[model samples]
Target chain A: MIIGQIKDGIVLDHITAGKSPEIYQILCLDKLDCTIATIQNAESLKMGRKDIIKIGKVIDINFDVLGYIDPGITVNVIRDGKLAKRERLTLPERVTDIIKCKNPRCISSVEQELRQEFRLADRERKIYRCIYCDSEAKKQI
Target chain B: MRHLIDIQQLSREDISRLIETALDIIENPGRYSEVCRHKKLATLFFEPSTRTRLSFEAAMYELGGDVLGFSESNSSSAAKGESVSDTARTVGCYADIIAMRHPKEGAPLVASRTAGVPVINAGDGGHNHPTQTLADLLTIYREKGSFNNLTIGCCGDLKFGRTVHSLISAMSRYENVKFVLISPEELKVPKYIKTDVLEANNIPYIESTSLEDNIGKLDILYMTRVQRERFFNEADYLRLKDSYVLTPEKLKAAKADLSVMHPLPRVNEISVAVDDDPRACYFKQVLNGKYMRMALILKLLEVAV
Candidate 1:
């Protein structure tokens, strides 16, 4: 059963289970004044398992952060308890100002004060590359 | 431009512009010093590549920029089981731009996605080395005065040398080029390269195990180290490692103007006796690398910021 509802906010659907912490971090939800419900490990007839993040207020989505966390997450804007707009946040052509390059020797990673930037060249392959240090966003732990 | 993940994103016009910028830096070093002044470059090297690491730092320093980041993997938080993405998110808060080198394939690509700053791939496992290829292009342009219609003979470990593979892919795009792949039977150029690059494009080429036999007919002699570790048996390695060395006697057979190039950090592939020869361009290659790097830093920073 659909438990209750959000009056006015954004609903992030189709998130992988147990990824709310990262999604929360990506959206900077903790720092904001809003209600966030992260549902993980739920049974779905369509999807074997699913996750969702329901926000109580409308916040301008940070697409770079969203794309990085899970390229598959979709953000839906709810207005007056009606779905105003729902679309998958396509990865940007060039991702800028959302992530810090982890290449310890990368010029951006080494210099403590400098802000790291990477361009999202391809979304399907989930490839993001650094402009200065030439480091790529590697998903491998 | 947040990340420079692949060379495919760059058009030929882009590469030409970069080379032109590099040439400008070589001609006037003082003009571009402050271009990146006060900016910091973070270098995250998870692997040990002394030459590449130093070359990158030198590039940033020459631009009046400061350098930060680690040279070793052990010193970083990654040792404690921090994920590459999480580490990148944290590091992104600190650095303006980042360069990463990891032993794992596609590590840089992963870091690039998570980084807020510009990312440069120094070397990611053996998948791609675009910057080194850029340096090679700059070196060829500066040394040969052009990038067209010339024979490039790559000798040594063709199968494993990342430099050789990148150069071949880059050079194959040029006009009127032929390749002389010189390596032992045990260390032939990979079949994929020959099929995908040479024959597919109909670029004329020949392969041989004897460097001396092919030395006289080439315009460029590219040497790569034939490591003992690549061989299964010690006797075979001992037998073939010395077979391809460029000796003074071998140079006698080469053309008077035949240029000899090595990717560097040489380990007896090219004799010390050949160092004094005018044909040896490896030392010049090193300096050219610095100049080219200076050019790259200037161009990338200018375009992005």
Candidate 2:
């Protein structure tokens, strides 16, 4: 397990192992942020195995992406080399911005400029419904 | 709901709400112009369907939203090796909604899993066409005035007709709804329709190889095509194709109020002369498709509202 702490930034710990790339892409952190360290297959007490990404800035994070990518991730705001804020991510009750839907033919997939929106219909299964075309995604199955 | 995969998932009340919404849009079109203002609808049609695709875009346009997306598979990224899920995830980032039609079974289902936006299955391979089902329901309500105590004659290809199957499944929910399955012996209604929809549900129905023989008995004549490609041999196609044609002369044998319907882009299955007949409701069905879709959009949005 590769373990290294960030000098001055937020640490995203307890992400589901092997889901780092999806998190990286969804957050759009490839361009603006610097000194980002991504570690996978790290052992954790909470999650038998985990992934962690430490970012070196206070840039606004999209809690939605964190909620969607991995609900198990613990977002810790680090200030002056000390942990400032720590909380487990919770998926939003209603998603105003959807990243995907169960329907392949939805306009959002074809167009280059629309934001996907969904309502969390069944929280336990993570079932989401698209507002535009009314497609359902059953996350559990 | 991002993807409409199957009609079995929707309740009867859900179907009614969709139909009522479509009727409202038909009755008052202007009221929904700006309902989807600043929004966009993307249509990804892998198969060629000029009518169905247009109806979906029209539904969005009527709601004051703009439309974008491809009408054919060759014109889009599908020609490349991009997986449906990969393409869907990328597009979900851009569009607010998506409606897809593919020749492969469960293509839209795969899209729904990966898409970040809402997805509508326009039609899948001989599977489901829920939107078209809604159009049929609205057409029945508008033309026949009610769905109860009616006999529907489903004429033409039964084995491969998605519309026919969907219509039968929907009408089975109404009271005293009987089906007159009309087609050549070679093109008879599938056994699944008999065992699954009619028999399982105990809906009254009969199968026949004659169209005009029972034309006068039906309240609605539902016409479908006998595709030459669906036949195994050229001789079989030649033998069965003419068996289902609905000519104007045959109209005289039908009830005066007997409505004729076709989920159409008719290629001789229904004669052109029949278009001018008062009983013809196929063209009106096209108009009803747009209205029904508008109703669906409004209802889904209201859930979000």
lDDT of each: 0.76, 0.78
True contacts kept of each: 0.00, 0.00
Q: Could you tell me the TM-score of chain A in candidate 2?
A: 0.80
Residue B182 CA displacement from its true place in model 2, Å: 1.2
lDDT of 2 at A50: 86
Candidate 1 lDDT tens digits, B1-305 = 54665554566777788888888888888887777888778889987778888988998888889899898889988777676666777788887778888765456667877787778878765446667777878878877887787899999988656678778887887789899999878778866567656887789999998887788988889898765544557997787766577899989998888889998779988999999998898887777777776766666566332
Each model's total of backbone clashes: 67, 31
Q: B276, model 1: CA deviation in Å?
A: 1.3
The DockQ of predicted model 2 stands at: 0.02
Name the lDDT of candidate 1.
0.76
For candidate 2, write residues B182-290 as lDDT tens digits.
8777677666567657987899898888887889999999999876644458997777776667888888898999989998878888999999999999988898888
Candidate 1 has what TM-score? Answer: 0.65
All candidates: TM-score: 0.65, 0.66
